[model samples]
Target: MSLKSTVIFLLSLITVMAKAQIDTAKIKSYADQVMVRVNIDTNIERYVFTEGPEDKPLETILSINNKTRASFSVDYKIISGTVSFTPNFLPGNNDNELKGSSSYADFRFRFFPKKIIQTVYYKKVKGFYIENMQDFFPEWKEGKDAYLQFPDLKIQSFGGSTAYVMKKDFSLKSIYTQGEWQKESRGSWVPVIDYDLSIFTDIIDGRKNRDTQYSIGASMGYFYNWVLGKKNRVNIAPNVGLGLGGMFSSTRDILDDGTKSSKENTQYLTIRFATGLHIGYNTDRLLFGGKFNVTSSAYNEKGNQNVQNNNLYGLIYIGYRFPPPGVVKRNYDKIQKKIPIL
Candidate 1:
């Protein structure tokens, strides 16, 4: 409001704006530039596991950082450090590669040891001019020679596990499900997983179907799957999920037929549970599983709890498996660091 106050406010705003506008190029113009290098490729692939239901496509569920993932495994060597990589990226993964060459490894990757080296160097091959690096790509000034060092990171590699719910879902075909599992005994999949839950909604459902159903309460029960014998690639699996939940059928308005139907369109709570069976269909790390349980939570006319006393409930699901997309290619080089330049 006053002249002095206005000037001070304007100057502060200008200062903040200038700071916000700082760029990589400006940071490269430093009086003293130093670079560090390591003997490994800095850029690598990242993956995570995922889940799916019958309707939506199975996706590698992303973590908090927001990135799709497939699998995780660790790599460790005698003197070499450890790094994490996705199993889908390469066959046998880092551990398999090491196993073939080494007589014995002190630690298995499953142990997930911590031994990342710091301030390592790489072979100096060829590089851009220092003037250009200083003026343009400030991030590329780590090498003393042609081969510039990549930025050092505290995390050497990534290796962990995850859980996924099914997204691309399926419908209930038959009441009973049975088959042989790849790892399980050679016989029928447990048939009639009692208390099986099954969701009986349309295929085109979203928001977990928001704006569509009212306060719904659901729960799930028994499940079953259909596994195949060795002929089906030794582990070809067809999945069936079973569970139950409750969704309010808020569609009791006057129908186009105009029978003045108040069909059970009352507002009810949604509560559902489900059981699912995922089948293994590919050599690649993929899963295609499904559910068929029942959800049994409902609401009264006033959106209050109203679960049916009956055990047969509608089934809903959440999962991390998917059908093997025909053929999958693995980057063998990325898997084995003695990688070939493609």
Candidate 2:
């Protein structure tokens, strides 16, 4: 062949070789993929994950609410497998799942961190809880010295009850919870103290030596409640309790306007101090003859014993009581004749 013909023939052969290489790679790329699985830590909050001994990191395909989905063609690359997420959700199907849902139908796509997957954990930020207020008072009228395994979820509650608690007026003052519910054995709303350890910067200036001084505090709380008195009829409801680590870091930050930015970057800690009385009652549940405690608070700080100064916490509950089911009116004339105080 002439010089030009020889060059053209070589180029044609090179093109054919490149095409064969592409075709071969495509045929072998997906033959050894593996199936994906999931591990759950419902208690932990910030969703995290990891890879197992015989596994690789999953590429997140979706993440919303308490669900997540990750995709990986690597299954086809290794064990030739496919990924399908099955969610334990309510009211929906594969074809018509909810938008932005972590349900079975729509959780197959999530944003995954590009790295080796570790065991997934949740990030705990905030929750509602209750306080077991009976310990401090041994003479409580009802259910004194009782502790039901701390409440995990509180449906509704009232801070104090006349039938189940000691005196209508308790010296224990108030019961506070860090989370949402308190302890009532048979009632569904057992109180649980949830942690809402938040991160923020604050600037506060308070002179503690005097009662007139002011201090700013940020508190997190949980919610729970129980059935009171008449067998699931009346609710001693919506017990809300919270604990802020004694480390009440407060600050004053303002940007041009009077708005302040309370953002802090420090090692976070939630220290429990001074078992104070917690009294907060919502109007909806406390409508006995009238409403009860609009709000109640207590806080204690570490100080010198010589100072002899401490914040005094008090009790204030406003509610009405109904007569028991068997209560009957007496005949005034006959009763007065038998025992007359006049």
Candidate 3:
């Protein structure tokens, strides 16, 4: 039992099994150096106070990268912005004709985490329309040359939400949106004895009407960061938000003896708001941005009805910042907490 004490205990058990197999191959080469990025965004939504003729925006977005927080992100959305009206209804001294716009491509789910981060969402939207239908059916417009002309309409939506974030910028958002909207076009107001004042058209046949909505909301936001020059990374952020919620609406129309007239699903009370102005330019491997946003929604159903919708958008982004995946830090500089969130 003495061959140099068994060769120094077999060389201290082969130096502890070669330092535990070189720390399990540096933790499998730091989980195969994980670092992923992908993003695409395009937007357009504006009301600006509403007036008429001006519509074209279907919203499109795609993103990925939450490798446990790369500024957080996991979103995918496709929106059918809005605009459609063929011959739904017109009677108050008519004049209607203008059909060339429609959209539909439902599918939405979001989890945008930075810039005050924290957001969870779900949506199932469908063909949205109605921006300034003569400021909401002013008897289908009478005065100004009896205005009314919208084509192709059908809207639907589904929803879900959860949000919470603190300090790292500040944000609190909650949401839920249910939907169903429709449009119909038939004939009305007879008068063609021998006096030109034509007002009746349905190009390819039509008759459909529906409106239903369910909403919930909550908002509170703030973001502040102004780093510029001198390797400060040139970044600027400004944000604001407000919220209130309640909405339940239903309206169905179709009656000329075929009997079908509904409009009792009322439960309104809503207010939502948003504002943003952000600019970015980070390096270590590119990251650029230019964002300008303003949004609002107000609805108070009942006598003297009050409805409001205002949205303005602008967003351009380009990203790529992968260079930090190299570890096994040989004791990670004697361990000093470097974002290993666990």
TM-score per candidate: 0.19, 0.18, 0.25
Better of 1 and 2 by lDDT: 2
- Per-candidate Cα lDDT values, in order, are 0.24, 0.25, 0.37
Which stretches of candidate 3 lie above 4 Å from their native place? Answer: 1-41, 44-152, 155-207, 212-218, 231-233, 238-242, 256-260, 268-277, 281-288, 292-314, 317-342
List where candidate 2 sits over 4 angstroms from the true fold.
1-212, 228-233, 237-242, 245-342
CA-RMSD of model 1: 30.3
Model 3 is weakest, by summed lDDT over 10 consecutive residues, at 174-183
**On residues 133-215, what C-alpha lDDT tens digit does candidate 3 reach at each position?**
44556555433442233343333344544444443222111111001000111111111111111111122235556566667
Candidate rank order under TM-score: 3, 1, 2
RMSD of candidates 1 onward, in order = 30.3, 32.8, 26.3
Task: Identify the superior model by TM-score, candidate 1 or candidate 3.
Answer: 3
Ranking by lDDT: 3, 2, 1
In model 2, what lDDT does residue 299 have? Answer: 36
lDDT of model number 3: 0.37
lDDT (10s digit) by residue, model 2, range 203-317? 2232111011222233332222222343322323223233343223333345555554554422223322121213333222232111122222233223311111111223333
